[model samples]
Target: MGISLQKGQKISLEKEAGGGLTRIVMGLGWDAAKGKSGGMLGGLFGGGGGESIDLDASCLLFDEPGNLVDTVWFRQLRSQDRSIEHTGDNRTGEGEGDDEQIKVDLAAVPANVKSLVFTVNNFTGQDFSKVENAYCRIINGSNNSEIARYDLSCQGSHSAMIMAKVYRHGGEWKMHAIGEVGQGRTAEQLLPQIKPHL
Candidate 1:
């Protein structure tokens, strides 16, 4: 068990690990909300039931001035500098855990990069109200141990969420849980909503 983060809470990675971390993995998971039966006909025809949600996890690298440097997402599995890599896309949120994952080599990250923002977008255009049990967690890559986790309990009509961010602070790495919901289907479309947090 690791530290469970509340919305807007921040934690130092170095302090949590008891030392500097070389690499880490940000895992995102979610499932579709089970729909109520719409009468006998609905159940017989599978009208009202749980449907698969296609949520995409993305990492956006930003500089000190909040300019986008590069991104790692389903389309682009690897960052331009090669310091970040997305495991792959999981279309159906039907598995047990971590529908999508983005791995980062903290030490290998370019010096000019100051922050890495993690986001989840409902790419299939379904609002988050149709989602359930969504969460974002950080795991130490070295030992596969969870360092911290933030549950995305905000269920609404929004189509996207700015989950959390790992940023440099005072020569050390720290994480902040944003948990902000908005409208966007891709990282590029979410840029405006992301600037306020930067």
Candidate 2:
């Protein structure tokens, strides 16, 4: 079983997996909160329903100096070096499992790259209070086994969350659950809030 992480908690990737973690996937999932009234027409006509909740998952690559070197998100699905790639974007959190997934090859990561930050934002401008059963999980790419998971349990008025970070620690990679809340419709707007967490 994988470790359940709390805010600001950190764990070694290699240690958790019992071996080197070369390739990994950061999976994010969530469910849209039900409207105060009715099914679909009620929400569309009188309540907050029918409208899709567009949540975007993003990965920011930072160098040793904490400077952003690259990004992988909906618009830009692949990094320049191709070390990271976003599987695809999920406009609504209506699916069964992961709404969005980002794959990373640790061995292929550039020497200068030291940190990869994962973030999620409500592109539709809906607050997290309208989102339920949200979680971010790390999975071993080779065997598809979960290594760690962080649950976003608290509902907030914010539209964005800095979910987690995977960084190099003493020649080994470590993962940290950040869980910081902020206001942003896109990843670019969350940069200011994300840097502080790094």
Candidate 3:
């Protein structure tokens, strides 16, 4: 598996009303084109040049083998306090991220925490559908009976940040399809990206 990790970016979770958390591990990976023009705009009207992936608002979770969450497709699981890992990798074609691996220890989370959220936003893209084969899964802390996942790259659009859902699943505290908010074709605005689901 190709995993990438930024020095200061990774998964995160916090709960104020729950018992206590001690360990949190997050895995992140993405496919790189490494050819032709990069995903990020090389020069906006011949202005600035930079990397290919901007990850100031991305997170990870545990899931299956074939399942995947590519780029900006994991917008169905909405976190109350959504985790945002920024790495400044904003291009999609020219270059690649650090190591395709990220790490987060739950034990390191802040105390007195209440609720958590996972949101993927603020990506420079020519289209949203280009961000394909996306998915996410959250592993349970108790008995590990929790399992939640969603398909995030189905819509036809090619350039829209999404808000994934985050709620309990199977009676075992879990995260499910909190629903998507940016990939909708008709929903032209950001509000429509997540409001109708509410």
Candidate with top TM-score is 1
List where candidate 3 sits over 4 angstroms from the true fold: 1-22, 26-56, 59-90, 93-104, 139-148, 161-173, 183-198
lDDT (C-alpha, whole model) for all candidates: 0.90, 0.88, 0.33
Q: By TM-score, how accurate is candidate 3?
A: 0.40
lDDT of 2: 0.88
TM-score each candidate: 0.94, 0.93, 0.40
| Runs of candidate 1 exceeding 4 Å displacement | 36-46
Clashing pairs in 2: none
By TM-score, is 1 or 3 better? 1
As for TM-score, the candidate ahead, 2 or 3, is 2
Pick the winner on lDDT between candidates 2 and 3: 2
List clashing residue pairs in candidate 1.
none
**lDDT, candidate 3, residue 182?**
52
How do the residues 92-123 of candidate 1 rate in per-residue lDDT, one tens digit apiece? Answer: 78979788999999999999999999999999
Q: What tens digits encode model 2's per-residue C-alpha lDDT throughout 93-193? A: 89798999999999999999989999999998778867888999999998999999999856878999999999998999999899999899888888888
Give per-candidate clash totals: 0, 0, 52
Name the lDDT value of residue 131 in candidate 2.
82
Better of 1 and 3 by lDDT: 1
